[model samples]
Target: MSTITHRLPQKRHLVTELPGPKSVALAERRQAAVPAGLGSGVPVYAVDGDGGVLVDVDGNSLIDLGSGIAVTTVGASNAAVADAVAAQAHHLIHTCFLVTPYEGYVAVAEKLNELTPGDHEKRTALFNSGAEAVENAVKVARVATGRDAVVAFDHAYHGRTNLTMALTAKSVPYKHNFGPFAPEVYRMPMSYPYRDPLGDDGVAAARRAITAIGTQIGADGVAAVIVEPIQGEGGFVVPAPGFLPTLAQWCRANGIVFVADEVQSGFCRTGDWFACEHEGVVPDIVTTAKGIAGGMPLAGVTGRAELMDAVHPGGLGGTYSGNPVACAAALAAIDQMETLDLCARARAIGEIATSSLTATAALLAADGREVIGDIRGRGGMIAVELVRPGTSEPAPDLAKAVAAGALARGLVILTCGTYGNVIRLLPPLVIDDALLREGLAILGEVLAESA
Candidate 1:
């Protein structure tokens, strides 16, 4: 086993239960003051974090399997990230990249161009969040191609904004009441082999989607086809091996831009700099946010120079775009990723998670119960879907139980997927193996008991 030092000094220690009196009190206050809607996916209240451990308000130390929804890849409270942020804050925080451009911003963009999967001359625009990046990708595509229609896949989870929501597939939470969305945004079937259309190869599924675009919006009128190489919230659905390449080829032939939303899978979370590399697919545009800055709020769209330059000088920037602090943190984060070999660590984490979850799944099957229907993912970004016996029906109840059970035993896990039946793990790549194994052992225990 290998050992790594945590970045932050340990302070608050677990004294009470998972959510002690302090956390309960804070929750009550939050409920009274904050809106009913904006709490959190996981019930735990974070006070601080270091390495792969989250320190809760109640003083409970939890082994974090969810890296702040995959936003902190280097580690929570990374030393390089903190030092860079502090140094930049003392000098300058924000001048608005549009008003007074900064060197850090340009440096970060250069790093992105060098790192993201592409050999062509590329450019980048920084933003504040994943949703903003996705929205800007559409804008750039439209400006460069002079088209209005944007195509996305079924079971896709782009973002929560009007345009991105329309591009998103699920209705219950993301799109149910958010109607009258942006126009000309179309949805097509994604290549989900677990629940793929009958007699359809993944390539065929992509072609079917392209055919729908031709019939509905006409290829001449389409601006871009956006996809997640591995569907994040829709489930950790890894499309067939050739699916993305085939789609990219079609887009090239049609002169339609291909955008890869690597927001959740980028920054070494999936054992690679970007998920599209797994398929050798080079997207015309790539959007990345989570994990890019070691938890700082930063997102970017990197693409061909001509398409990016198509936007007018004042057309693509915001008041806070390319914030200096975020840019500095991002530079440090990228350095950490490289120096620590976090990509390889991500692959090791995935192997450990898959082995543990698959073993638990087998035990459940022997007992005539099904706790995990599938354990699938790449690198450190892994997921386990809970299902009812002999059926593919989503088992959200079981998922909730397992998560709560893990929490009670001092492990922090997160659940996602359209049905909320999938348990996704995005632990920091710098986590200690002993701690990682401890968390996985707890998860196995929870699954066995739940079954």
Candidate 2:
């Protein structure tokens, strides 16, 4: 079971100094070809990836703990997904779902509607990216409710589009000089236990966000309340227990369409098929992407039938939305997930991560190094929040150094959060146990050395 299918060895091997001569030359080419705004986390260029390792251009096999920012949850080269993609590509790639609707797109929508929370009659619209899904979700909400105001929580990351930028709270990187963003998007206090004064009391924190919504945005005017089931990019912040439920209930009572942005925390990345299930919150609209199509560019907006049907006949859809090839890949990915029981695998991975990180933090503390401010998340999506030693102050610099150190050791890790102080572990669910631990050990050593 520990030996996940892959052509390359599952061990971390560094043959060259990070960006070897070949990678250095490619970097020079990339600097000239690619825009500076687009950044890469790992220094080396990837040639192939499967199972738990990424083979770089310089013959270095780096352990991939980021899963390409949580997109390749089924691994980079699942045989089934590849075969499906190839079969579909051989037949028909795209005919424009709108012009000549295909069964693949309809089949994917049917699957999404069936899988998302709640057994009630649901519908789904496919799109190209998470931002596009989010934007359309809001569009559906506003059209159905006839309201313009929308409420988003703090530390929320819907996407990078103009509307999503307004929905986001962080500024420097995501929102810097990108205004004037879409108007009528209100930010509410999220149930952030680590940073909130309320501590672990999720009920009270929900109350705070609800009150702010009523006073600041006028709940009556709100078309939707969009939030990440487990905030990704915004530090992997999991709202305290009872927090999401309270907000969902409030939205229900106020006639607001509760939109759960599960773009990053969906598709078994958080143990459950969807992170909102952790809190038993059935959102009115669920935005999905990232791990949806086995790295294929596909997004979905699943919601109540009435809300989705409210839009005009041609209101939703794009030229490449739900491309046949992507749908085929999604189908095979779903088959692999169900047959392999990836949800259970994710839970097992979560267990290992929580135990290892907690033990490592305790050991570090015993040595008088207390940089780990918090450790949180479920399933394979774990986060280690770094803080100043002996204090709760955020330490972004320390987080950067730790990630860089791990990269030097041939482990590809990712750091995220509004303050950029959280190291998030998003290994593919198919990662072998030994490889996952080896990656964890490298991260632990890097953090310890950073102290």
Residue range 20-130, candidate 2, lDDT tens digits: 889999999999999999988777899989888898888999999999999999999888899999999999988998999899999999999988999989999999999
lDDT digits (tens) for residues 1-40 of candidate 1: 1345775543224578767788778888888899975647
Q: Candidate 1 versus the native: TM-score?
A: 0.97
RMSD of 1: 1.8
Clashing pairs for model 2 are: none
Alpha-carbon runs more than 4 Å astray in model 2: 1-4
What's the CA RMSD for each of the models? 1.8, 1.1
